[model samples]
Target chain A: MIPVTVLTGFLGSGKTTLLARLLKSPEFARTAVIINEFGAVGIDHDLVEAGEESFVQLETGCLCCTIRGDLEATMADLVARRADGVVPPFERIVIETSGLADPAPILNAIMSEGARGSGLALGGIVTTVDAVTGLATLAREAQSVRQAAVADRLILTKSDLAGEAADLRVRLAALNPRAPLSEALFGEIDAGVLLYTEYDRLDDFHTHTHHVHADDIQCIAIRRSEPMRALTLTLLLEALADHCGAGLLRLKGIINVAEYPHRPAIIHGVQHIFHAPAWLEGWSTADHDTRLVLIGRGLSEAWVLNLIAAIEAEIAEIAPQQAPAPL
Target chain B: MDEALLALITSSLALWERAGDVRREAGGAIALESEGHEVRITRAAPDVPFRWSITIDGRARVASSVPGLLRVLRAGLDPDFRPSRVRIAPIGITPS
Candidate 1:
C-alpha cells in the first residue's frame, strides 16, 4: 500500500519552510506532494519548491469540508493516470494541509477514502507547532489544539527564536501525552521519525492512540468477536455518516468480512466521507475478530452499539435468506 | 457507477446552489431544471460507447465517462465554473 503522510499546523507555523527543506531530502525524493490552500487563489504552491510535476495543488476549500470528494477523486485520478502513464509515477504521497485544517478528517480521508484496492496506506500525522507563539496559538485557536492532539509526531518550529518552552511543553503533554515531540530548528528534522514504517509499534502503540481526557476527543475501541456481513459494515458507516456528522472524527480498523474471511478489509472514514474499503491479502492480527478504533467528539459507545445491532436486525429481517455481496 | 454519477451531479448541484434543481426522473434517469432550461441525463444505449447523453437547450451532447458528462453539464449550465488546472510536480530524484 502507498503511504500518505499529512503535514498540518496553524497559519505561519513554518510548514512551508519545513516542506522546502523536506523536498530536498533524499527520502522525500519521488514523493507526490499535495499542497492544499483554503482560498480561491492558491499561493502556497508558488511559495514552496517541490518536484515540478509531483506537487498536486488542491484548493478544495478545506481538507475537512464538503470538497473532500475532490480530494478523493484527485487521488483516484492521480493513481489512474499514473497507471495509464498520464502522470508521473511517485513512490509516496504527502499532503500539506492549510493552517486552519482539522487534521482528523484529512487523515481520515487519506486512510479511508482511498479505499480498497487503492493501494494507499495512512503514513503518519506530523504537526508543526510554532514554538515562538505555539502556546498562545494553542490556547487561542481550537483548530491548532486539535491538529496537535491528533498528530503522531509534533515538530516545534522556530525553536531557535524562542526561549523557555516549559509551559508550552506542559500544555502540549496535557493535551496529547502520546505524540513524540521535537523541535524543527533550521527547518530540519530527522526524516525517519516523521516518515517511519512499522506504524504498529507495540511498545508505543498507546502513545499514538487517541487518549486525550482534557479535550473531548477520545478513542472508542469497537471489538467484534463474530464475523460481520460486509453489508452490515456498509450500513453501519452510512448510519454513522447520517447521524454522527462532525461528532465522528476518524474511524480506522481491520474488519473481518464474513464473505472474505481470508482477506481482511481495512475500513477508514473522516466525518461522512468513507473511503472505499481496502481488502488486505491476509489477516495481520493473530486473533482475527473485527477491531475498530473511533476517535471522535462525544462519541457514545452504547449508542453506536445499539445502532449497529438495530441495523443488522433490520437487514436480517428484511433479507433473511441472503446476505448482500461483500462490499 | 450509478452512485458515482449521482454523487458527481449532486455535488455539482450543491455547488450551483439554487441555480438549478436536480431530480430523479422515471426509468433511472436524472433531470436538471433551471429557469427556462432543462437538461435530461439518461444512460446511453449499451451498444453506444458513451455513458451519458446530456440534453440542454434541445441539443444533446454525448460524454464517454462521468467526468466527461460533468464537463459537458457545467459548460451548458454554470458560467462561473472553471476547472482548476491540476499540476503534478515532474519526476525528480529517486530514493535509493
Candidate 2:
C-alpha cells in the first residue's frame, strides 16, 4: 500500500518551507507531492522544488470543500499514470492541504474505498504550528486548534525567531496527548520522523481526562470492555452523525466486534463520512478493549455513554424476535 | 427506556446548539418544543413492526426505530437540521 502523508497547518505556518526543504533531501527524492491552495492562483507549488512528473498543484479550491471529489480522481489518475509508465514511480505521496482547510474531510477522501482500491493508505498527519504566533493563532482561529488536535506529529516552525512557548506546548499537549511534539528551525527537520509515524492507540484515556478548549472544541475518549455487535456499532455511528452533525468533528476507534473476536476493526470517521472498518489480523496486545477518541465541539460525555447504552438495550430487546427459527 | 429517550433528546438539542425544552409527559410520552415547533414521541403498539409513534404538529408518523424517531423530531424542531447521511465506503476491490 502506498502511504499518503497529510501536511497541514494554519495560514503562514511554514508548510511550504518545510515541504520545499523535505523535497531537497535524499529521503523525499522519490515522493509524489500534492499541494492544495485556495483562490485562483497558488504560489506554494512554485516554492517547492521537485520533478514535474510527480508534482501536482490544486489551485481550484480547498481540498476539504469544493475539490474533495477532485482529490480522489487526482490520486487515481496519478496512480494510473505511474502504472502506465507515464510518470515517475513514486513510492509515497504527500498532500499539503490549504492553510484554512479542515484535515478531516481530506482524510476521509484519502481513506475512501476508491483511493484504497487504487492502493493508497493513510500514512500519518503532520501539522505545523508557528512558534512566533502559534499561541495567538490557536486562540483566535478554531481551524488552527483543529489542525493541531488531529495531528500525529506537531512541528513548531520558526522556533529560532520566538521565545519558548511553554503555554502553547501545554495547551497542545492537553488537546492531544498522544502526538509527539518537535521543533523545526527554518522548516528543517528529519523527514523520516515526519512521514513514517503511526496512529497511536488511545490507551491513556483511563488516566487522562477529557479536555475542552475555549472554542468549545472538546477531546473525548470512550473505552468499552465488552465487544459490540457489528449492527450495534453501525447504529451508534449513524445516530451520532444524525444528531451531532458538524458538532462531530472527528471520531476514530479500534473496535472489538463480537462476531470477529480475534480480528479487530479499525474505524475512522470525519463528520458524516465514515470509512468502512478495516479488519486487523490480531490484537497487538493482550488487552482487547475497544478504544475510541472523539474530538468535537460541545459534545457531552454522559450523553454519548447514554446513547450507546440505549442503542444496545434496544437492539438486545429486538434481536430475539428477529432471530431466525430452526426448521 | 423513556428516561433514556428523554436524556437523548435533551442532549440532541444541546448538540444542535438550539434552545428547546424536552420533558416526559404522563403515559410515558416525551414532548419537545423548540422555536414554535412541537414534537411528542410515544411507544407504538407491540403488534406493529414500528417501535415509536412520533407526532409533529398534530400529524402522527410511525417510526421503525429510535434513529427514525430522532430524524422526525429533528425535522420538526430545527429548520436547518439536515441529516448527514452516513456513507460507508465499500471494502475490497470493485471492477475498475
**TM-scores vs. true structure, each candidate:** 0.60, 0.85
Where is model 2 chain B poorest over a 10-residue stretch in terms of lDDT? B87-96
Model 2 misplacement above 4 A: A24-29, A39-42, A50-61, A174-178, A196-198, A201-209, A320-327, B17-40, B85-96
DockQ winner among the candidates?
A: 2
- Candidate 2 per-residue lDDT, tens place, A1-327, comes to 888999999999999999999888778867888899998788888888886445655555888887666899998888998899887899889999999998978988888989988998787889999998999999898889889988878999998888788888888888766668998876789887666634344433354335455456677877788887777788778777877667777888878877777877778777777777767677777778888777777677777877777777677778856532211
Scored by lDDT, the top model is: 2
The alpha-carbon lDDT assigned to residue B14 of candidate 1 equals: 51
Predicted model 2 interface RMSD: 4.8
Per-residue accuracy of model 1 over A1-327 as CA lDDT, tens digit each: 778888899999998888878887777777788888888888887877776456555554777775566777767776787789876787788889999888866665666534324777777788899989999998899899888876767899998888758888888776666567988877888776667632342112432223444566665666777787766676566555544556666666677777777776666666666666656677555767677666567665655665566546645754688864543
RMSD of candidates 1 onward, in order: 13.6, 4.1
Q: Please compute the TM-score of chain B alone for each predicted structure, in the order given.
A: 0.73, 0.80
Query: Could you say which candidate leads in TM-score?
Result: 2
For model 1, report DockQ: 0.02
Each model's lDDT: 0.69, 0.79
What DockQ does each listed candidate score?
A: 0.02, 0.36
**Model 2: lDDT to the true structure:** 0.79
